[model samples]
Target chain A: MNTINQYYAGLDMGSVSIKAVIISNQKITGWALIPSGGNYKTAATTVMTQALAAAKIRREDLCGIGVTGLGAQSTPFDARPMSDISCQARGCHVFFPSARTLIDIGGQFTKTAKITDKGKIADFLMSEKCATGSGRFLQVISRILQVPIEEIGELSLTSQHPIKFSTNCAVFAESETISRIAEGAKPADILAGVHKAMASKVNMLLKRIKLAPDVVLTGGGGEDAGLAKAIGQIIGHPILVPPNPRLTAAFGAACLTMETTSG
Target chain B: MDTQSQVKTTAVKGTDTAREVRPMVKDIYKAAHEARENGKKVAYMMVASHYDEILRAMDIVPLPTENYAGLCAAKRDMDRFLLRAEADGYSQVLCSYARIGLGFDSLRKELGHIPEGSPDGGMPLPDMMIGSSAICDPRFKWYQATSRYLEAPTFSIDVVAPPPQADLNRVRDYYINYQKEQFQGLIEFCEKQTHTKMDKEKLWEAIRLGDKAWQLWYDIDRLRVAIPSPMPSQDHFSIMVAGHYYTGTQKAVDFYQKLYDEVKYKADNHIGVIKDEKYRILYGGGLPPWHTLWIFNYFESFGAVFAIENVYRGFDPVQVPSHVTDPVDFLAWRTWLRATAYHEKARQNSGNPTVEKLLGIIKDYAIDGVMFHACRSCRATTVGQTHIKTELGKYCDLPMMQLVSDMVDLRDYSEAQWKAQIGAFIDALEARTDQE
Candidate 1:
C-alpha cells in the first residue's frame, strides 16, 4: 500500500483516450493510457486501476484526485474537475518552467494556451467548428493509408517529395488522399502532406495568441514527430515536448490534487 | 392557436418576460401574413438600421430579416432553407441568416406561394428593402441580392464612422443633415411606391413612441445590475426582437412597460433568475446560439446566470437629447448613435472599447467570470476576441473562457463538447472563488 508517503491521482477522460497519472512526493510515479472507446466510465476505471498497479500504491492511500478533459465531469471518481486549459498550463510548467506558450492537440479539438511565469493561463485559442488540426484527422489519414497511427510520423519523415493537400477539412482530405493514392502517390508523401496541413492550421492558432518563446507541446498529437517537426518548421523555432507529452494533462491533474489536498 | 394563448400554455416555468415577449414576436409574423393577404406593402429592414419607426409611420409593415433567421434557428429548421440557398450557388461562407432568408425568398418565388414547412407560414415578400453600412458588408449585399430577386426598391443609408478624436457634438450637425436628406428621399420613394404622402403628425407620434419604449428598455436592463440579477440575458434576447422591429408601435411600448414592471417586481422580491444563484457571468462576445438556448439551463444547473450579453448591451439605442424636436433629426441622431455607441463608449474608457465595456460590466454586475461564444460565422464579433481576453486580463483578475460554436447552425455545435467546456469553466470559477 506504500503507506509511508501520501499519493495523489489524476484522471483525464479525453474524447479519444482515458489517461491516468499517479504522483508521490511531487514526482510522477506511474501513468497509463487506454482508448476511451464508447463508455468513458469503464475506460476511466480500467486506466486508473492500471495506473495504481504500476505505481504499486493501494487506492486507499490516495489523498485526493483531480480530473480534466472533455469527459472529465462524467468520470465516476471522487475528484475535482478542472479545465484542460489550466491543467495543461500546470503540466507544461512542471516540465518547462520558462514555457510561455502551450499547444495541446487532442482528439476532437486543438487548443493553444498562453502561460505566465507563475504557471497561470493568461489567454487561449481553440479550434472551432472544425477538426482540421486534431488527432482525429491524423487517425483518419492513417486508416486510409493502411498504416498504423504511430508509424505515420516515421513514414512521413522518409518522404522525398510531399504532395500538397488543398483542403483542411478531415472528410474532404480523406477523399483527396484516396485520389492521390489512386494516382500512384507514395504513402510517405501523402502522410507528409497531412502533417503539413495540420501544422499550418496549428500555426494559425499559435499566431493568434502570439507564440511566446519556450513553447511547450502536449496532448495525443504531440506524440507525432512529423507533426512536431512540421510545426517547428512553420514557426521557424524549436518547441518543447515533455517526457510524457500525452499524459501531461493527467499529470497536471495529479499536481492539482496534491495542491488542494495539502492546503 | 393565437399567440397569446400559445404563450400562456407553453411558457417555461419562471420566465415571465420571455412568455410575454413570445406572443409579441408571433404577432409580428401574424401581421406580416395579414399584410400580404390584404395587399398592403411590407418592407424588409436589416437589424443594423433604426428605420422601423419611419416604415410604421407610413403604414408599412416592417419585416426584420434577422428576426426571421432567429426564429428558424430557434425552431431548428434552418437546415433545409440553408441547403436550398447553398444549392443555388450562394457561398457557404455567407452569414447563415442571409443564407436562410435568401433560400426562403428564392423558394417562395419559385413556388409562387409559401413553401411547405416555412416558419409560421413564411415571411411576406417585401415591396422595399432597407439596409445600412453601419455593421457588416454582407448585410448590404444580402439586402441587394434579395431586392433584385423580388424586384423591390432598395435604399441603403450610408453611415460614416466617427473619427477617433472627433467631437460627436461638433460633428453632429454634418451627420444629421446628411441623414435628414436621405430620410426625405426615402419618404419620397415610399410615397411614390404606395401612392400616399407621408403625414408629418404620424411620423412624430411614431418617433415619440419608439423613443419612450427604448428608454423603458434601458431602464429595465439597468435593473439587472442588482445582486442575483433579476433576469437572465435570454429573456432580454427575446424581448429585444420586439424592440428591433416593433418599437414604433403601441404594442411594443406596452410590452416594454409590462416587462419593466415584472423585472422590477423580481428585484423588489429579491428573486434571482436562477434559484440560489452562485455565480453571475457576462457573455462578452458573439451572438447567442439560438438553436440550443437550453445552454442557459446548463449554466443554471451550476447555479450560474448570464447577467448580460454583449449583443444585448449593444442593442440599446444611445440616449438622444430631449431638445431635438424635429422627427427626421431625431431619427438621424438615433441612427448615428446606435451605429457607433459601443465603440465610442469603449474609446471613452481608454483602450479597446470591447475590453473596456466588458470590464465595466463585470464591476457593475459583480460578474464572477466571462464567457465568449466565439461564433464561427460572425467574423466581426469573433475577431479580436482572444485579444480582448488578453487585454481584459491586464485590467481585471476574473476568469474567462471561450466556447467555439456557430451562431445558428446546429451541425456545427456538439452538445457534448459544449457541456465539457462549460463544466470545466464552472470548475475554474469555483476554484478561483475558493482560493479567494
Candidate 2:
C-alpha cells in the first residue's frame, strides 16, 4: 500500500485570481483561492501558504510542485510549469473519465479544453486576449447596480424579456448598458442578454475544438445559472456545471497534487 | 440604383495603396496605347511602397487596398481566404484590422481582383507568383494555397525578430541589409518575368526616393504623439494608407511631407485635440473597427486617447540617406531585416526573463495598466502575453487586462460579451485614475 506520506502542491496564477491546492499521499487534502490583484508573485506565495494551512501540512513536507495557468511559468515555486490547457484537462479528467470537454471561465480569462481519456489535450481553445464574456465583465455590470457578485446568477435567472445590448467593445457595451437602463430595460433582461452574449462566445470557442460532448463547466463564473443556460441554448445541448463552480479549479489542483505524490 | 444592380461598381475605397483602384486616365491611355500597339491586354494594380518591392519584382503593379465605406473593407475576402481564421488564432482578441482586411478581400473579388503592380495598370497574371510573409503568416498561406490552384511559384520571406537582449539598433541594421537582398532577388524575378533587364541605376534611383519618403513619415510619426495628441484617428488612418507606398519612391516623400505639413500646421496652431488628454494608449497592432466606435468611445470616456498605432503607421521609420546615394538597394536591404528584427528583440528580452524594461515602458508611457492581448494564433505577438503579464506585475501596480477575440475574422466576435469586458477594463482604468 502507498504510505500516503508524500505531499504535492499545484498553483494556478491567473490575471485576476490565484488558486492553490495541496495533497498529502494521494488523498484530497485542501485548497485556497485568493485575489491575484496584479501581483502574481505575492499571490503565489500567499496562496501556497494558505493551502498549506488549510490542509494542516508544513511547506517543507511538499515533495513535488506543479504549476499551471497563465502565470504558471512565472510562479516562485520550482516545478514543471505546464500550459493552462494541459493542467485544466488533467485536473478535470480525474473526477470524470467520460468528460471530454472542460470549460473554465475565470474572473478574467475563459479557456475551453478538449481532454482525452488519457488526460492529454487533443485540442483546445481559449479567450485570453480579450476579457469580454468573462466573469470580470459581469463584475462590472453588477457593481454598477451595487449588487454583490454572488447574487448575479440568481437575479439573471429571474429576468423576463432578455434585453439585447449592441456592440462587442466592453467600453462601448457599458455605455450601451446605460442606454438599456435609460430605455427602462429590466436589469434581469439586461443580465439575460449579457448571458446570451457569453453563450455565443463560448459556443464559437467550442465549435472550433469540434464541440466535444460530456462538457464540464468549471471556474468562478461556472456557478452562474444564467450563463450556463445561455451557453446551453447556444450550444444547443444540456451542459453540466460543477457545484460551487469557483472552487473547481482549486479542487482540480488538489486532485493534481494527489496524483503527483502517489506516483 | 437597383437593390442588387450588379453593374461594375468599383469596390476600391480608403487609402490602402495595395487595393485602391483609381482609374488613371493617362496611365490607362498609355497602357491601352502600349497594349493596343503590342496587341496585349492592359491591366494594373497600384501597390504600397513598402510592398512595392515584392509586387514590382514579380512584375505585378501593386495597388494599395483601401477601406472607404467601412472602417475595414477587406474583412470578407480575408475571412473567405482564411476560413478558420479565428479558430486558427491568427488574430489577437482585438485585431479588428484583420477583420477589416477580410471585408476588402471580399468586396474586391466581385469585380475581378486587381493584382498590386505597375504605376501603369493591373498586373498581367500570367500564372506564377512569389512573395513574403513578413507582415503576417496568413498571406503566406493564402498565396501558397492560391498557387496550389494556379500552379504558380510562390516564395515566402519568413520574418525573424532580433533577440531582445541584443543591441536593438544593431538588429534593425542587420535586418536592413537582409531586406535589400530579398528585394534584389525579387527584382531579378521580375526581370525574368518581363524578359528585360532592369536598369540598376533606375532601380537604385527608385530606392533612394523611396528611402526619403519612408523616413519623412517616421520622423513625422515621432512628433505626432505629443502630450496634447497632435492628430485625429481619421487623419492618422489616411496618412497610414498613403504612407504604405512611401518607402521607396517620390510618393513617400510627397505624401509624408504633405502629412508633416498638415500635422505641423495643426500642432503649431493648436488645431486638434491636444490638451488635457489624460491617458494615451498604444492602439497596438491590427485594425480598429469603425463599426465599433464605442470601443474607442469607451476609452475616450476615460479621457484615453489612442495616440498612434504601429499597424496604421506602416513602415515609415528610417534614416533617409542622401539622394545621391543608392536608394533601391537601401530599401531592399532594410526590407529583408524588418521581417525578423522585432521578433529577435522580443526573443532576446525573454532570454534573461526579467520585466524591468517592460516596467520601464509602462512608466515611460505613463501607462497605469497593461493590456496584453492573447491573440489566438499570432505566435509573434501573443505567444507570451501571460508571461509578459507576470513580468509586468513585478514592475508596477498597473492593472493588466487581457481581452479575447479574433482580430481579423468578424464572425468570431461575441458582440455583447466583448463589450462587457472592455467596459470593465475602462472602469478599472477609471477606478485606478480616481484613486491616483
Candidate 3:
C-alpha cells in the first residue's frame, strides 16, 4: 500500500515579519520566521527552508500547500492562499479548542477575530491603518528606547508604575517616548506604558467583536509581556499566549489542509 | 513651478484652465436659470467626474463629486438610507456607507422640501436624477431607487466586462467600444445643445487630451511615491480638479508637465516618496472621486507612500469580450466600468463583486493600509464600509481606515472629526511600530 503525506503551508508576509508553518492533518509540525526586508522573496524562501528543516520533511512530500497571511496569495509556489483571519483562527484552535476570539497584533495591523464553535471565523474587526500598536509602530518606538525587541518582553515585566504617553500619531508618539526618556523615566516603565496604550488600541477592536471569553493573542507583537499583560488586564480576562505567539499564523497556515481547500 | 502654483486660478488669466472653468461656472449659473425659466426645477446634480459625461448628456448641472461640505446634515441623513435598506431587506453583506447614505438621504432635512434656493456652491438636488453608476453594487441600487422616486430617467450602464478567458487584443477592442459609446452619449448631448455633429476632430481632441492628462498625472504621481510620502493627502483635491476638469484642455497637459518637472527637481534634491529613513505605505482607498484624492495622498510626507489605488485602476481589468458596434454605448460604458463605479462601471469598490478581487491588488501592491471612502451619495460604497474594513481585517488581516465623505458635497467635510479619526488611527499604527 502506498500513502502520501497531506501537507498544508501558511505564509504570513507581514510588514515586519515573514512567517511560514508546515502542518499535517491539522497539526502544526514545524514553523519559522524572518524579518521582512527589501526583497520579500528572499525572506519567504528563508522561512520556508527553515520550516522544512524543522519539520524533518522533504519539500516534495507535500500533498498541497495552503498559504495565508498579508502576502499569502503572493506565496511563490502558486499554493492556494486563504485570508489571515481564516488561517489565524485555524491556527489558534489547534491549541486551545475553546479560543473563540483571536486578537492578532502584528507589525502594521491589529486584527480581532471571533471564531465559531467549529474553529471557523464568525466575525472580526481591526484597528485603523496607522502603525501605533502594530509591529511597524513598535520598531520605531523600540529605536527611541534603545531596547532590543527580544528583550522588550522580559524588560517590561520589571516595570512598576509605567508612564503613559500622549498623542496617538506614530511621529508624535515617538516624540513623547523621547521626552519621557529626557525626563528620566524608567525605560522599562515607559515600555510598559506604551504596551498599555497598545492594549487600549486593541481593546477598542475587541469591543467590536464583543470581547468573547478565552481570547487568543497571536502575531509578532504578542511576544511582548507588556502587551500580553496589558491586553489581559484591559479585557478583564486571562489572555492565552501561545509558546511562540509570532508563529501562530504560520503554524495555522500549515494546519489548514482540508481536501477541498475551500471555505 | 510646481503644478500647485502654476494652476492657481488667482495667478493666471486667459489660461485655458480658468477659461474653461469660468464658462462652465457661468453656464451652470445660466442653466440653473434656464431650467427654472423652463418651469423645470433647476437641480444642482453633483456627481463624481466619472459620471459627469452621462449626467452632462442628460442635461443636468452636475456638482463636482467630492468630499462632503462638513459632515453635519450628511451624517444625520444616514437614517434615511437605513430606512431604505430596512424596507428593501438588504443582505448582511452590505457595508455601512450605503446604510448610512440611504438613511441620511431618506431624512426630511426640512419638512419634505429641498429648501428652495441654497445654491451657494452647495450640492444642489436634481429634479429627476440620482447618480448611480454602481461603482459598487449597493449604490447602483440606491441611485436606481432614487431615480424612481424622482420619476427621473435613471439609465443604468451595466459595465459588462470581458472574461478572463478573453484575449488582451479583444480587451483593447472592448475599450474602444466602451469609450465610443460614452463619447457618443456626450456628443449627442453636446450636439443637441450646440446643434453640431460632435465634430469628430473635437472627440479625437478630447480623447487625446484626456490620455495626455492621464500620462502627466502618472508622471506627477511617480513623485508622490517618495519619502515623507512626498505630498500630503490634503492636496489631492486640487490635483484632481486640475487633472479631471483641465485634462480636457492643452492647458492641463502643460500644467502637468510643468508640475512633473518641479517634482522631478525636488526628487533630485532628495525630497520625495523614498526618504532614506521613512516607512513607505501603499494606501488603498475608494476612488478619490473628485475633490478628495488629495486626502488619500496626505500621508506622503509622513513616512508613507501610496504606490497604487485599486479603485483608480478599474481599467486594469478592462478587456473586451466581443466587438461593440455602438461606439457611443461603448464610450459611455467604458467611462461607466472604470470610474463613477455605479452599475455599468462595475467598479470594484465596497459591496461589489470586485471588492474581493481588489484585495489581490492591495496584496500585490504591498499597501500599508486600505482606506475605504465611505461616500454619502454613493449608496454602493457607503453602506458596507464597516463590513469591508472588517472583512479585510479578517481575510487579509490588513489595517483599514474609512473617511465618511460625499461623492461631491464639499460642505460635509469636518476638519475636527477627520483630525481626531486620523489621530486615533495614527496612534494605532504607531503602537504597532515594534516599540522597544
Instruction: Go through the candidates in order and give each one's C-alpha lDDT.
Output: 0.81, 0.56, 0.56
Runs of candidate 2 with Cα error greater than 4 angstroms are A1-263, B1-51, B54-60, B63-128, B148-155, B158-162, B165-181, B232-235, B271-276, B286-294, B312-329, B332-365, B368-379
Error of 3 at B257 (Å): 44
Residue lDDT tens for model 3, B193-297 = 434454444444554565577677766665655443344333333344455444346666776676677666665665543344233343445444343334433
Positional deviation of B110 in candidate 3, in angstroms? 39
Local distance difference test, candidate 1: 0.81
TM-score of chain A of each: 0.96, 0.90, 0.92
Higher lDDT: candidate 1 or 2? Answer: 1
Model 3 lDDT per residue over A1-263, tens place: 12235666677777677987777676667788888787777788888889888888878866666665665545677676555666677778888898989988887677787776566665556565577857777778788888888788688889998887787778888888888889999989988888888888889888866778889989877787778888899999998978788878666666665434633
Comparing 1 with 2 on DockQ, the higher-scoring candidate is: 1
Over 4 Å off, model 3:
A1-5, A258-263, B1-436
Model 1 docking grade: acceptable
Cα lDDT for residue B193, candidate 3? 41
lDDT of 2 by residue, B73-111 (tens): 221233333443334344444233333333333323444
How much of the true contact map at the interface does candidate 2 reproduce, as a fraction? 0.03
